[model samples]
Target: MKSLQKLATIALAIILMGSCTAQEEATTLKDALKDYFYIGTALNVPQVAGQDPQAIEIVKTHFNSVVAENCMKMMYLQPEEGVFFWDEADAFIEFAEANDMQVIGHTLVWHSQAPRWMFVDENGDQVSRERLIERMKTHVQTVVERYKGRVHGWDVVNETILDDGSWRQSPWVRIIGPEFVQMAFEFAHEIDPDVELYYNDYSVSRPEKRDGIYNMVKDLIDNGVKIDAVGLQGHLSMDFPTVEMKEEALQKLASLGVKVMVTEMDITVLPWPSRRHSAEVSLNYEISDEYNPYPNGLSEESYTALMDKYVDFFEMFMRNKDIISRVTVWGVDDNQSWRNNWPIRGRTDYPLLFDRDYQPKSAVTRIIELANAKKQ
Candidate 1:
């Protein structure tokens, strides 16, 4: 029976691989990592709605998991209070289902991209703690209930902890208190008891913030919250957060007895800016040739440097795949990545496994080769 079950997993993988007539079946990221963890990519509205043929091809062929990059966020889904937009969110889930892929609902709660109405009343007064909690419950219930069993997990809360291990003091904390995190998780769980819940943050690999997350999650687990995973937002760069830093983080988060996922994984190969370490949505800079050095193109030396960096990270991920349920590149390819406009408005960044042309980078091939070789 065990042998038969292994055969079944392979057979299903092949069917998902589909047919390649003119050539032998092409090697894919998902297939290579099937025995390790789910390989996933993020989708914007274009790909979710079947508009980007190139990204759709990559999603269907190389990825078995998908996350909505923006469509499922609070501002996009509920730009105004009591009125929700379901078109893009629904289309996102539908796309995943149609492709036989697992869906990770990007986020159910976040301080960034949240509607301004959520924290205040019509009179422009900050809502009371009780009032805000009710609002949160309603929002989570409506959204989580809509996609209950379809999604593998949700980043139930995002970026609430600071790098110094202090709470960020976002309006949620000011009004709803630290328990806001717990409430959001509870609300999501109440709607779908089966869905996995995650606490996601960036800069969590730093020991100071890592200890902060550990203590916060330990309290929640001790209180019997349904926390299933901790998302290490691996928004990496060519140099920041050494491999040892991440490896230690992986083991520390796993100590909590919950699975770890390298959510929102991307490695920007551009020059670092002032706010070099944070993925703050508000971080922006005026572009100059200094930061935007690669606007024309990446040099051979720079490209090889980026490739080596990716290989190092992927190797670490593979080593710790037992506790890592998924490793998702933040975008489909270079052209679609948010890094291009992030930190600086007009800098070019090569961050993902695929290039601007939708061709898989040599780094991707190397990672796939390493994965296959390990399994063999």
Candidate 2:
């Protein structure tokens, strides 16, 4: 009986020590990058509602900022004129406050996900410019006022510029002119002057689009519009937008005296489609096995390639830390990444720091080491 008791005591001690080591090894990304910039992730409905235990744990353990992936968009927030839904957005903000995380209102104006009623009347004809502008003001003011001080930042306008440096023919522009962008910014500022306002978009690293964004921001500042930051949606891949391209764009945007944020950062490991520049959110491809190459799982070589790509981007981010204010991963883990269903549906893509099991990937350790080294 004495020998048995001794063995049990030793086993318990070993288990405790192993647990401690694992916890220690799980260095939180937020802490690692605390000196540099905010580490953030987008929260899907499951995460925002506290339904996914594993994802919520990862968010609390690793991130300091959060954005709603869809809940705060115009369609969901204001499905009809003068009818605003606050259940999901309210819960999201509450969750952020409870966790002591910074919250970003994803967008006030975008071509997609906005209700068609705003652009058309009961007769299905385009609303007059005066009517459209008034509706825009009301929507922006109401949304921004509701979360004035609670939300730290707002993407007032999203994906407004095209690859050719021209304004995308969004309904807002079609009816109210490009000044709609400026109006949205002004309204947001009027409600919450302290909150940061950002112009968010993808494909910002392309030279033409980058130039367009720079000019637009410069114009806004020149006209006394309060634009605080530029959010470059970092939905990148392993190959395109080389480090030099990204750095050049960052430097140029920073030169305008506005902070830059790498929002929605993720790397799709799957093969690119032919129409890569199409900014259509609803675009999809027919299911094909060729596109889903790693259906079984990523091989050692593929995984290494993904890690290397992330490290390269992190190194670039560290080098440009002065201008970058925040680096937000698109989702908490690979299982929740939008890439799995984008361009091609039903394809498995690993594009984030955490794996499907909620374990930190090797890149997480490498990034922590990089951050720590920078601090030293």
Candidate 3:
């Protein structure tokens, strides 16, 4: 059975490869990618200086959009509850607008990095469902209204779905239940009426997670909520669920009439089964122990393997560009990636197009090639 599965995976990959023959005809990687992909990256607020000029230039030369400074919803945007702060976000918004770059708002409501002041009873636990809904409505209305036309889209909610395909135990979820996702979207739509709204989550490359998103979005669509796209936060490891699963999930979501975007793509190369890692990384449910090793940083061979995986996945996406809209990297460089302490702590992780020194990685070159290749 395992052998047959391998055969089938290869067979399907071959068919996809044949269908993506444009990858072969492209003379240069950049030329090919420009035609098929929207290559963009997230920017840190502090790093947007002398570095930003060069970084934005590189992006303008190669990509189309920019995901602004983690834009952590109303809490960060309006830390004083009603008072909104756009000083940092404005720098990016204005920069992108000045450069004619598309802008994607990182998130509106999320489980993590939420302001501590959001939902607190007098005792400081959390607000009730009723209060939470009001907060959601107010936050969405205020911020979305401020940037209604300038902002291209909002990650209406981020990481509300867990790795096990269950709704996260967020304050919003604990109080508002499943309706929170719908309410978030409705409020955003009512406020902007124009900005594209998406539900963004990590590990969407997994089948269960992808299916969870599909089910939720489909339900929202059936209930008459306006959801525009799904952002697959493609934070990948060296060896994990094949892109085949990711592709299948994207196709299914597309069938639901929602656009798909590779929102936060980064491939982390970490040592396998390292004692310092947690049960999640050690268990290798998503990847075999043999495929990963300890001292979990990306090795030369692992980098190459991961790059190939990216090529295969993007080829699949290019073939389906009719539904998938953008391909965004979580960070501009490896040094900026969150993978350093995530999934594996204290271990160095190389997970972006550019290295810590801001030099382009070979993976970036190959991805460009895949993106540029014309369809056969």
TM-score to true structure, per model:
0.92, 0.92, 0.82
Which should have the higher lDDT, number 2 or number 3?
2
What are the per-residue Cα lDDT tens digits for candidate 2 across 65-153? 99999999999999988899999999999999999999999989898999879999879999999988888889999999999889999
In Å, residue 304's CA in model 1 sits off its true spot by: 0.7
List of clashing residue pairs for candidate 2: none
lDDT of every predicted structure (CA atoms): 0.88, 0.90, 0.74
- Model 3 Cα lDDT, one tens digit per residue, 256-353: 98898888777766655553222232232344445335344556777778677767777777887788888888777666677766654455677777
Model 3 deviation from the true structure expressed as Cα RMSD, one decimal place: 10.6
Ranking by lDDT: 2, 1, 3
- Model 2 CA deviation exceeding 4 Å by range: 1-26, 275-279
Q: What C-alpha lDDT, on a 0 to 100 scale, does residue 237 get in candidate 2?
A: 82
Most accurate candidate by lDDT: 2
Would you give me the overall lDDT of model 3? 0.74
